[model samples]
Target: MKRFLVAPLVVALAAVTLAVLPGSPAAAALIDARVGALTFRPDAPGTGARRLASASVRQDLYLDRVSGTFVLDAEPVAGTTSYLRVTFGHLDAGRSCQGDLELRTDTTSPSNGFTRSGRTLRLVATERRFGYQDWDCAFAVLDLDTNGDASDGSVRSVLIGELTDVPARPVLAVTGVQLLDARALRLVRGVWTTIEVTVANRGRADAARVVLRGSGRGVQVRPTPVGVVRDDDDTTVQVRVRLTGKRATTLRLTASGGGATASRSVRVARAKAPARPRPGTYRSADGDTTFSVSGGKIRGFRVRTTTRCGGYPDIPTTTYNTYSFRTVGVPRNGIVVAKEKGRLYTARLQLRIAGGKVTQGRFSYAGPAACFAVERFTASRRR
Candidate 1:
């Protein structure tokens, strides 16, 4: 149950000869230079025999060759297995070619198996034999299978060549962020605004399980999850934030993945005083609904609605109706209730008046044992 993960460590070389002289060719290009070795151990009690003794790797750029050796501290008991992961620094030169990798080992029975993910290699080894199982990779992996129950020693020498298939390691960077909603330009205190944030990934590989975080004074941001973003591609996500105070502020958004992070900020300003409700016939932006307002009442209110209940069609049917309602609060904002009621639901409307018109509103029809949906809309005074 113990797992050891060896991260890639860079081992700097002081000098790399590149020039070719008579009868002597230059070494292969050092596309990647890094720490080339790692070791793992088993910590679980009563499992000392299953621990990894040691591991070593070497790279000879001139011959395009990579080699490694692995040994277990002791022979493991039957049915006992240990898992280990090791990462070699930047071994990929291009896209990962699991098929281009050629593997060889000493023992083939009681086989140890291994798999590759990106540059990280996973191996399952026991006391007998460790060998490479079928896997795609961008780096070298030693698959060992110890010959029949050898209680003496488990030593593996892996000779691997054809190292040209490794891909360039993928780099993740948050390229940019864009505010897709105009409401973000002017934020109102104590009101929640849902804005669209477009997160872009300019990377060599797809970013998985991406997350967006927002921060600011007088602001409350809802952390958003943005799933896989393919290399060079972008995805947009919605973020809901509330400004709790009148002070102007800025909202900072950051996206991170693959050890890289990027951030962008948006300016927020206190909203101006709201304009009074203007008396006029207003039409919804969609032109599918309309309502008229006079000082303290809403008239000629019309919208589509649906309801489903016992004795009604399984799928709610749609219908349009004209309604009249009295404002129950301030002239700028109030709830309007219709006098008529159906057996399954009652109709109600909430309206917000600003900038000389009915700026936004919600219409709902609901009751016990019924399905009622709230429809939200915006309308401007008809010109």
Candidate 2:
């Protein structure tokens, strides 16, 4: 949709007399104005008679006895389109003025449908069409004989008004509720499962201010009162719940708004804990290094390396460095944390494994005389 702002030019008028005034003597002191009951009736000839649907209008203006201006704005309702006309009555009393206005986003000067007779002004902004549903128009009335400065006129009356098309009533339905991860359907006790609830609006008009709610035994739902669901649209509400009981359980979720409601359920079963990796040797992609785990604990690392020294064999020589690690925390979330110590250095390592394989590992070491090194490796279990 196109969006534009319409601001009316201020009118400064030199005093002039008029035979008829719009409202009353009090109209001169009026500083505010408003439009009431702005409505639109589809003028399309032939598709069964339809009720007049109300369209929203918003206006901003400065008014007084001698001069004023107003900007009216609105967006046409979705679906049907017809001639949308706006009429203002008893506006800016005791002033003789003219208006130049345009509808939609047309850049040319507005040439038709703006007229003032007695106390009322009427304008047919545009014929509503597809992709041209939004409109903003400015209306200004100035005293007849201002010598070019708008602020010189006596303060008259100001009118700001808005017309909004009411969206059709909404019908809410709970489309589905499923675990974010299919594997999480069988939930383990003491663990959290993430699920999503799909809410759909099956109505022609937009739905406003919908609230979603969920309930179940032995479960805690985070983020209650899910936000709104629009018309002919669907929104997913994410819920994270921790199951405390071991047996099977069901979760019920409901979406309610605009005098309509829907509900759905998800069933979860108690499952055994995931199995830990077997304690064995795992070799890196390169054959020069290997890691070993025993009794669910990471124990040792062996690396083949070449070093250069002046007094060794008078050249670079190959050597083997083997370091033993002391296992620390029990495995959790597929990770094992441990510490390795050597005569002159100490190191901390974290190893991550999944599906019976050591996917990656890292270690950091510090030694005397400020020696330090950090390394990472990826490995798989030996066949």
lDDT of each: 0.48, 0.46
TM-score of 2: 0.31
Error of 1 at 249 (Å): 2.2
For candidate 2, write residues 196-268 as lDDT tens digits. Answer: 5678987644556677776788765665565667777998665666678868888777787777778877786
lDDT of 1: 0.48
Q: Write the per-residue lDDT of candidate 1 for residues 1-383, one digit (tens) a residue.
A: 11111111111110112122377436532232112334222122323334444555544332344445544545443444333322233223332122322233222122235443322333432321111121212222222232321122332211112222232222444444433223345656776655667777654566777788889998888888887777667886666666777789998888776555678777877765466666778788777667776765556777754444433546554444444433443332222222346676566665566754665567766666555556777788884
Error of 1 at 287 (Å): 5.3
| Global Cα RMSD, each model | 19.1, 17.5
Candidate 1 residues lying further than 4 Å off, grouped into runs, are 1-184, 273-281, 284-379
Candidate 1 worst ten-residue window by lDDT: 2-11
